[model samples]
Target: MLLPSLYFEEGFKVIGNMVNTAFGKFNLTGKTALITGAAGLLGQQHASALLEIGATVVLTDISAEALGAACTALSCESTASRILTRVMDVSRAESITTVAEEFSDRRIDILVNNAAIDPKVNGDAGIQETSRLENFPLVQWELQLAVGLTGAFLCSQVFGSAMASDGRGGVILNIASDLSVFSPDQRLYRKEGLPADLQPVKPVTYSVIKAGLVGLTRYLATYWAEQGVRANALSPGGVFNGQGDEFVTRLTSLIPLGRMAKADEYQSVVQFLCTDASAYLNGQNIVMDGGRSVW
Candidate 1:
């Protein structure tokens, strides 16, 4: 039985299209996440987690090199095709808009605002007892705010506004510091080589910026409540990769749990905030300290 050439060609095309559609629907599918600061530790972890659970992750970072490196690493994985990379300055409106447009419908399902910079601290030991506030340099404050608070607002306002209009009620998770929730009580704080004035007062422009993030999340949540968009903050405790024994000992002691938090310890908490598991959890700051702030 000879079949017509045109019929054979059409049948082949139909089969191919079915396979492609099935693969698209079944492959780590369901929602796209736009992760800002995607090169940082927490940002990488967050993106990887989402990828693990079947997400199309759009990555953005201030550094093209770092972002390229991360995207390269993710691409090597079997699921690498799910990752998208872009250079974005979260503090800038135009940058976010440019990236947002890359998504097919201008509807991003998730936004992770995880960009921040800790200000450079310069001071001498036991200077709190002697230094004056007026002597600290002003440049440090400017740098800190530029990266931390200003950047967060830029992403939130733009990404958040888009999400509000998208109608799916997307989720926003702002990475904040546990220090934002409760002030760190590191006793006998000392930094050598810092100016006397910069030493005595708490120069937590980083933490203060994070504190502002909490309020931002809440206010956005309230305004967008009717819109399907939810916003929340996840404040992590001091993440110590390898502080010296003395530094770790001094800092961990203040933590009632007696140890600094490991990086992966934050995974579960962060995943919760970013997932459907926390569908009703909105406008709240979840602190991931090991009981340090409470103590």
Candidate 2:
């Protein structure tokens, strides 16, 4: 090791090439990204991040009006040339297939499975009794799974297949939650003076659906490894979205960072996974929870 002064001087040019290539990994100049649940809060952020990096974004949601509004809003931040809006229900295989067919000539370089039903809990004294597990509606459970879990599966199958068949590998970013790796502390949602059985509690379905996405990520990562497809999951912590002050205080206390996540905090990681920066990353569940899951 001590005899490398000449080697170091001679290798400077080679090292420069590596440095340039490393930074260049994050450039997404010619890729196309398809985001599910693109009408929602997080979906818009995903679209913005990808578009900022020069990727063409396809925003897909079940509602035409909401999707249009999201696309319209994004137009202000990014040019209309960078975005396309489509109404596709992930719950229906046919709908996903149809959307894929429409994009048959194009390869989806990135897919963000970001749709999920995150039901809210009333922080008031008289909490809604329906939030309790004993009274949780079976219909709601089915609906949550269909859209969150099944939807991701179908999207992966359809668009993921397109990526595979095109001989151009793609990135599948599954949006999971911190709860995917841990159980919800019911105490966080509990309200004072409410009857024991009536206090609002986090539903079982939310955790189940999120955890299922991790499994899907692993499956897809391995299943399409040979075809240049990389699948990964992002388990994010609670985001500060104007939640009740009481709920925010309780949730923050649980996090070691003493705060919730900012909405745009995850966009960089989104860029990493969708580009060559994470080319070697696959079958990994990256947790970005402000150290909440650890605590």
TM-score between model 1 and native: 0.80
Distance from true position, residue 262, model 2, in Å? 0.6
Q: Tens digit of lDDT per residue, candidate 2, span 1-295?
A: 4867888887997999999988888888888999999999889988999998899999999899999899899999988988998899999999988988898887788999998888887745543577778888999999999999999999998888888886878899999999999999999988787778778888889999999999999999999999999999999899999988988999999899999999999999989888999999999999999999887
Best by TM-score: 2
Clashing pairs in 2: none
Worst 10 residues of 1 by lDDT: 127-136
Model 2 Cα displacement at 60 (Å)? Answer: 0.7
TM-scores for all predictions = 0.80, 0.92
lDDT of 2 at 2: 83
Count residue pairs with overlapping backbones in model 2.
0
Off-target runs (Cα >4 Å) in candidate 1 are 1-28, 76-78, 104-106, 120-136, 186-188, 191-202
